[model samples]
Target chain A: MSTQIPKNLKYTKEHEWILIEGDTATVGITDFAQSALGDIVFCETPEVGTELAQGKTFGVVESIKSVSDLYSPVSGTVIEKNSDVEGSPEKINSNAYESWLIKVKVKNPGEISQLMTAEAYDQFCQTSA
Target chain B: MTLRTSLYQKHVDLKAKIVDFAGWDMPVQYTSVKDETLAVRKKVGVFDVSHMGEFFAEGPDAIKFIDSLVTNDIASAAMGKAIYSPLCRENGTVVDDLIVYKLAEQKLLICVNASNIQKDFEWMNAHAGKYDVRFTNKSEHYSLLALQGPESEGILKKFIPNLPSLEYYSVWESGQTIIARTGYTGEDGFEIFGSHEYIGKLWDQLIAAGVTPCGLASRDVLRLEVCYPLYGHELNDEITPLDAALAWTVKLNKTSFIGKTALTDYKPKYKLVKLLVEKAIPREGYHVVDENDGVIGVVTSGTMSVVLNQGVAFARISSDKFSKGQNYFIDIRQKKYPATLVTKPFVQGGHK
Candidate 1:
């Protein structure tokens, strides 16, 4: 099934999406990614203030089938972590885009522009599937 | 290429997440594991078990030959009765755990694991010896559907009008189809055995009736919750029936079984026990350690039980007396958490 991808969000090739507001970027997995992972049982994200590099591992998302590494969409310092997601990881499976894992203060604003647009990401998902 | 069952296309249509299980392309889940797990417990669910192998032992000495091969005595079982046993090797370790069905005089049906089909066949053939027993591999000829849960009786009653009710561990053969009141899951269920075409028709009827199509993942969780020992995980070539705490299945007093010699007065060093871990989940191959970091044994099978909503695990620990709430630790990802030894059937199952 084709997953929903908002036109405004920038997507990473690793199936993560980042929503930019000023210099802060709210990052989470896309619907395609969550659907592929099945039911999320446990999610472990980096603590607040943790430094992350672009395309680097920042957390882990585990499902009943397998565990996947959550990668950072952009280089930044995590300003906020979603404790609710850590408590109940099913939020990501139910509402992936809204279940933002972390809020990062972007180290490089230009990196957001380099990510794939909604149309490109949608095509990429189809090709991958 | 991975082998696909007759219902393989159906699982694909249901958007089931397919995984390679024992050289067969099988569905792990359709919607989600937890949801399917719940469906089997609360409502009704169906599992395509076509990969499981079936063999027949017929002729004059079928019962005697089968009894010599398995840990459980087959001669005592009445016709239409099924008995569970560990098909053991000479060293008393499990070759595979299977169910033997007693049919008309001198006829028996053996249900073996999919992964161990060829091995079991070869082993049984090698021991055929002087007995007038014929071993016929009927695995490819039959397709199996396990209709499980509390509502299984009602769903099963639709097609099987004659079979009003079945007692536990019993079988009723109606022409080519065999309905067994048995299941790996602790639910009140029935295993329907028929040809691929017949099973396909039954699968369509169940699907159209809005019955939940479950996968192997939910089946594993359900069986684990009931403390059923999976073949590869709990009983393997190296792990004996006594070590796996399946001593009840092993009747050493019987004339002479395959593993009876080694099993005489067997006191196992390692014992399988259920552990309820706090917070963290324990997976297979994780260490079951003590306070001083001594690795007592290893975890065999485990999962986050959906019914209990907690981490439940089964481990094979040494016989050092850790019963009645004796504490231990499970080494998961280099961190140790306190766990307690508990009895089985972690969640209550079945209409019985």
Candidate 2:
């Protein structure tokens, strides 16, 4: 199954995607990540105002069989935590990229450039699969 | 190399997510486990459970030999009857949970867990002890097609014209097939046992009839939802039957079984209880702690209940944990999630 990687988003090796818009960036797991973690039951995200370091575990997404650590693409402070996704974790299964988990106010916007582009992430998913 | 069942190609053709389960290359799901689980509960679903092992104990002393090894009474099982029990060690610990089918007065067929096929054989052989019976592992000879749900009988009745009056926990032999009205899903279902080639053909027939092929993932969830005791999780060498809440499986009056002496008046220190967590899902080996933050016991089996949409799990807690009537918490990922004590069977059984 081919995973959907949107061109507008930057992705981390941990399969989290960051949509940088000004100082605030929306975060959610990529489609590839959600598919691999089938039938996600719970998503525990870092609370708002929580500081997350680059490549650090900011949250956890639990599937039926296993649990995966959701990492931050860049160092940032959590601006908003999606209560909607928490209430309905299956939303990620329906559309991973659409159900944003959190919005982080990026401390260093320049670090977003270090993440993989949509094309690069798609190729990475292929090789990994 | 992992073993492949007769329905492996069919699962592959359906674009199933295959995974290594008990050293077998089995499909985990075709679509999603949640969807598949719902289908089985609401409508109908078929499962390829051909990996389970089958053994035959045939001789004049078949009843004596089989009864001595298992915890349940073989005398209670008449001809063409199936009985559920655990193969226990001498010390009252379970070696494996299996079902025994009385093929004849001098013959008995046993269905065991796939992973415990070899172990159960070895244990049974060692304990036979001059019972004048021959134990043969016929696991490779049979392939099981589990047609489960409210519509299970309707689906199976289509092909088999002469439907034998098979009751629950009873087997009926019609030519080369053995139709047993038994399943772990707590549903009114049949485990059709036949040759691998025959099973493959039957699988195609079921799929053509629009039956959803469920995977082991959903099977585990469905069984857990009904409070059925799974071998490795709920029962083990160390976990007694009473500890797993399977006291019904142990018949202490059974004639001189392996674990009879030790479990004569056994009272388990741990009690199996169902819990519903707030949001976070509880997993195996997670600590179940008391209100005082002391580790009381551990979660044996856990999953997110599709029907309840909440974290439901079975944990083996100490009897003393409830003496003070304090609530319990499951320590998941270094965080404590409060869990409410609920009755057995996290969901009301939808079985007919």
Question: What are the C-alpha RMSDs, in order, of all predicted structures?
Answer: 2.3, 1.6
> Each predicted complex: what DockQ?
0.50, 0.75
Model 2 C-alpha RMSD to native: 1.6
lDDT for B335 (candidate 2)? 85
Give one clash count per candidate, in the order shown.
0, 0
- Measured with C-alpha atoms, the lDDT of residue B310 in candidate 2 is 79
Docking class of 1: medium
Model 2 TM-score (2 dp): 0.96
| Per-residue alpha-carbon lDDT of candidate 2 for residues B204-258, written as tens digits (9 for 90 to 100) | 9999999999999899889988888898898888967877778877887666888
Docking quality class, candidate 2: medium
Name the regions of candidate 1 deviating beyond 4 angstroms: A53-56, A107-115, B265-269, B318-326
Which ten-residue region of model 2 chain A has the weakest summed lDDT? A58-67
B63-82 per-residue lDDT for model 1 (tens digits)? 99999999997898788888
lDDT leader: 1
- How many residue pairs clash in model 2? 0
